[model samples]
Target: MSLVSQLKTLATRVGTEIKGLVRPDHPGLARAWVNFGYVGSAIQISSSHNVAGVARLAAGRYRVTFSTPFADTNYCWLAFARSNTNSNTQRMAIIRATTDTKTSAYVEVICATATGSLADTTEFNLMVFR
Candidate 1:
């Protein structure tokens, strides 16, 4: 092969590798994510990837199920939430529920008011990584 053709082939391969590394579907990146909230007392999933569904257990408590189960229960996760009116400060906790396996996560969203009680929010987001 000509030198120019060989260099072009090498450049294409390098570009493909870089793209794979940065793609959302990459094996080393996040496996699941969801943006959810309550709309008129019903759960609404605005957007998600690899998330099967979200269920509201009680006020400020929810369960997120993954479409594909992980190999084990060793994954890491992040959770965030905000108040409906955006007036109250919010704090969130991502937990492994007693019934959760490698395919689900449980989360709690609390509003930090003067009383410091657990309250539900308007929106919650979760991301899971393996």
Candidate 2:
């Protein structure tokens, strides 16, 4: 190869090596740098209906509430389902985000009453980020 071509190849190889060294499989990190928690809820109901308004649980709800940090954004996901059913009752399933002073987004899971006749106590699983 010509001298100029050989020099170009060497510079490319050196750049690649430097990048590899900068990013290892795992860098040493202190445990304090990681934050984690859980939030959830449970509720009971006697009839079929949709609950209105948002309740601010320990872990926030996922509906598009004014308080939802992700309400204005399109990058949020909601996962919920009813776990039990009978002739006299149905449960509401809900998932949402948790907000702090910084309003960081987190996941929450819960089941509530769809009808006013039933009662539900919600327990959420919360997780704080790194």
Candidate 3:
């Protein structure tokens, strides 16, 4: 390729990459650049997270698969779940998320009501930072 043409192509690629790294507009995620969330039955990774994918392990539990796994168990991450419009109450506050110590391949988020019952398809969001 001509030198001018090569430079133009490199600039375009860099611009596109910078745009893709922008984070979601969530206050809680200010410190955590990674962002992924579920909307009803669908799960999607925001531009910031750059994750591999997400899967519903159960009603309230989700497995977030990462494109690049964290370096270790000490990786900082957060998870939160909210009840859908059909099911809203204080119980949603009891939702919780956690990861295992053996590996950083994936983080599992489990959401439950205060009564200890799994919330049905609850909306959940997760963020991780190394």
**Most lDDT-accurate candidate:** 1
Poorest 10 consecutive residues of model 2 by lDDT? 29-38
Q: Give the C-alpha miss distance for residue 106 in model 2, angstroms.
A: 1.0
Residue 130's lDDT in candidate 2 = 25
Q: Compute each candidate's TM-score over C-alphas.
A: 0.68, 0.24, 0.55
lDDT of 3 at 116: 78
lDDT of 2 at 23: 55
Cα lDDT of model 2 by residue, 1-130, tens digit: 9999999999999999988776532233111111111223433222211122233443223321222233223333333333244566555444332532222232334445665222333322222212
- Residue clash pairs of candidate 3: none
Model 3 residue runs over 4 Å out of place are 1-48, 86-102
lDDT of 3 by residue, 1-130 (tens): 9999999999999999866776554333433333445565676555555467777677666666777766676666666665555554532423343342224777666667767776643345566765
Q: Considering lDDT, which of the candidate structures 2 and 3 is the better prediction for this target?
A: 3
lDDT string for model 1 (75-95, tens) is 787877775665655456535
